[model samples]
Structures are given as C-alpha cells and as structure tokens.
Target: MSLPPQANSTRKALVLFSGGQDSTACLAWALERYAQVETIGFDYGQRHRIELDCRQTVRRELAAQFPAWGAKLGDDHVLDLALLGQISDTALTESRAIEMQANGLPNTFVPGRNLLFLSFAATLAYRRGASVLVGGMCETDYSGYPDCRDNTLKALQVALSLGLDQSMTIETPLMFITKAQTWALTEQLGGAALNELVIEHTHTCYLGERQQRHAWGYGCGSCPACELRAQGYEGFLAQQRAGA
Candidate 1:
C-alpha cells in the first residue's frame, strides 16, 4: 500500500528498528509521516550483535546524508533484554544450527519477541506522548514468524490500547510487501539514493557477516535470511531490467 499523506506534523512516532532492510525502510517511512520520529532497538542478546552496530551506522549516515528527514530522528534507544537470550535456544540467540520446527517455523523464530517489542514500544510511546508505533513486521517474504502477521499486530494494537488506557496505532507499512517491494518502497520514499543506502548499510543476514556483499545486502549467503534477501533482490533487479 502507498503511504498516506503526512498528517499532523506535531504528532510523534516511535519505530521498532532493527537496522535491517525492513526496519530501516520503516524508519524512513515514519520520518516522512511524523514530525517527531524516534527509533528503539532491542539488544535481546542475539548472536548477531553486529546488527546493533549497523543500526548506529545507518542512523548516523541518514542524519548526515538526508538532513531534512534525518534531523527528525530523535534519540535512539537500545533496550537491554539479555534475559531473552538466556531463555531462548533459537538460532538467533544461540549458536545452534538453524532448522525448521515441526510447525514449519525456522529456528530463528523467537516466541513473543514481537509481542514484547510492541508492548515495550507502546509504553515508550506513551511516555513520549506519541500515538503511533511503527514496525517492519511483514508476513509476505517473511521467515514464517507468526507474530509478523497483520492479524497478530492488529490484536496486539487493541491489547496495548486497552491495557495502556490510551489510543495507540501500530503501523506496519511493510506488512504485505515482499522484499523486492520493500526495495521499491525505499526508492519511493527517498529516491534511488535512499535505496542504495539501504542496500549498503542495512544488515539482514542471520549470520551477521558484513564483508561479503551481495546485490541484496551483507550476509554469509548460507543462512535462510541471506537466501531470502538474495532472491528478492534478484527479482527486484530483474523487474528493473524489464522496465517494470
């Protein structure tokens, strides 16, 4: 879906950013819509801690390269949730081999991760007097994470609003878009330069390797995350070549 026009400039928004392609795009999306946009990242003790570095790098580059939107970037907050790592044995938090569960969920699936993230983001937004919480959870071209579904986010939005006794809107701009579409979105938001920055700075690989560059992003190229990103990027390039 195309982004709606900017509403009240005084309105504030908090984005659940992971410094990944989707979240970075969501960050730019939020900046376009809200006058005040702040990003929050989770240090959930994931094995791929390099993502945090990528987050910082992207934030800095955005502020430097795109001053108008970048200046809207408020304080960047990183919450320490190391306990999540201790409690979960998933490949994201653990060094174990990534595999699919009987239910077809990859080992990277961390139960309640998004739930907790949005809940926390709501609390933060409430404190900041923000009415909207932005995230990058997408069911399309996703890794089969149940929490990424639109229905799940809608339910969480209700629960958060009821529990907080405050009206809250959870914005999932990427909910129905594939990765290739996500790339298109970045270009639509800020043009080709923004898209290029996302491709170069965002980290989507499950293995968290920065040196090995591909058309998609940096990754070990062996993990499921890498494979998905690569495929989507290839599709995007093919579409571009076909003048679609």
Candidate 2:
C-alpha cells in the first residue's frame, strides 16, 4: 500500500512500539511518513520482559544505522502499567500455559490491552503536539485478539478525538497486513539492512528465550508468539523464492 503524503515536515507522530516484529515495522513506517517520530512502550509487568530490552536495543540500533531518521524520534517513553499485570492472570503475565479462554479468547489475551494502550498513547501524543498516533495492531494473522480489529481501533480513534477535543489520526499501517507483509514493509521503509537488523535484534518470544535463534529471530520456538513469527517469516521467504 502507498503511504499517505505528510501534511507538513513539522508534523510529528507517536508510535506504540512494543519492539516485536509488528511494532518494529510500525516504527519504521512512522519514520518514513512523519517528519518527527516518537515511540512509547508499556511496562505492564509482562512475563516476557525481554521484549522491553529488545525495544531499547532496536531504538539504539536504529539511531546508529539511520542517524537522520533516528534524529526525528523524540525521547522514547516506557510507561509503568505494573498495576495491569497485578490484576490480570494470563499467559502473557503469569506462568500459566496458553489456552483458549472460556469465552473463546486466547489465554494470552489481555482484555482492554490495546484500548488502554491507545488511550494512554493518545494522551501522550496530544501533549507532544503530535497529530498522528501509530500502532501495529493487526487482525490478520492475529491470535483472536478483539482489540486488534480495525473496527475497534477506528472506534477508539473517534472516541479519543472526541475526548481530547483535538483532531488525531490513528494510523494502523499493519492493521490489514499479515506478518509476512510486515517483513516486506520493513524492507520498503528502510532496506534489506534494516530488515536484517530487526530480525537480529527484535524479540517476540512469549517465553522470552534469547539464546536459541530460529529462522525468524530469537525465541523459544515452541510458544505461540514464536510460532506465528516463524510461520510469517517462512511465508515471506517462500514468497521471495517464488518471485525469484
């Protein structure tokens, strides 16, 4: 998909970056479209704290590799959402095995996660005078997370605009794209080098195992998150091979 033209070089954006593949791709997407881009991550006491480390690593690497683009990013913010983890007992927060919930949601599903995240991110964007907020939530190839749906994000966008009494466009470049498409997007935004940097630095394992690497990236290779990433990367490789 073609990226929309930037309204102005002064226009800034705040990206909801989790340092996972999708969010990392969104960060790259934001950098390409916005004159100034800032990223925010949540420290909601997740069991996989390695993702947070990945976030910082990715940020530093981007700053080093793409100095011009990285200069556009303001101070990165990592919010404390420890209370959310305290109240929620799920696979992502606790030691429980991942399974489908009784209500049909996955055990990894943290209810209202995106809602709260975007809400907070909107506030941050407003304060920073940013007209755009970007996130990597996707319905396609998702693990049945309701918050990842485009409709939900659109509704939340309207609600946030109304609440803030300001015009804020929530950009979800990865909303409709599959994970394989996300990898392609990384290349589109930067190049093969940036894509390789992401694969080498970003962490997506629910189990947070970094020692063992896979075809996709670092992960336990057995967790649901790793499986999804591996599948998408495999699909991406297949597509590349077929095109070749």
User: Each model's TM-score, in the order given?
Assistant: 0.96, 0.96
Cα lDDT tens digits for candidate 1, 122-189: 98889988899999999998888999999999999999999999999999998988988888788888
**In order, what lDDT does every prediction score?**
0.88, 0.87
Error of 2 at 62 (Å): 0.9
Report residue 217 deviation for candidate 1 (angstroms).
Answer: 2.1
CA shift at 72, candidate 1, in angstroms?
1.1
lDDT of 2: 0.87
Model 2 segments beyond 4 Å from truth? 1-4
Best by lDDT: 1
Error of 1 at 200 (Å): 1.6
lDDT of 1 at 24: 95
- Give the least accurate 10-residue stretch of model 1, judged by summed lDDT: 1-10
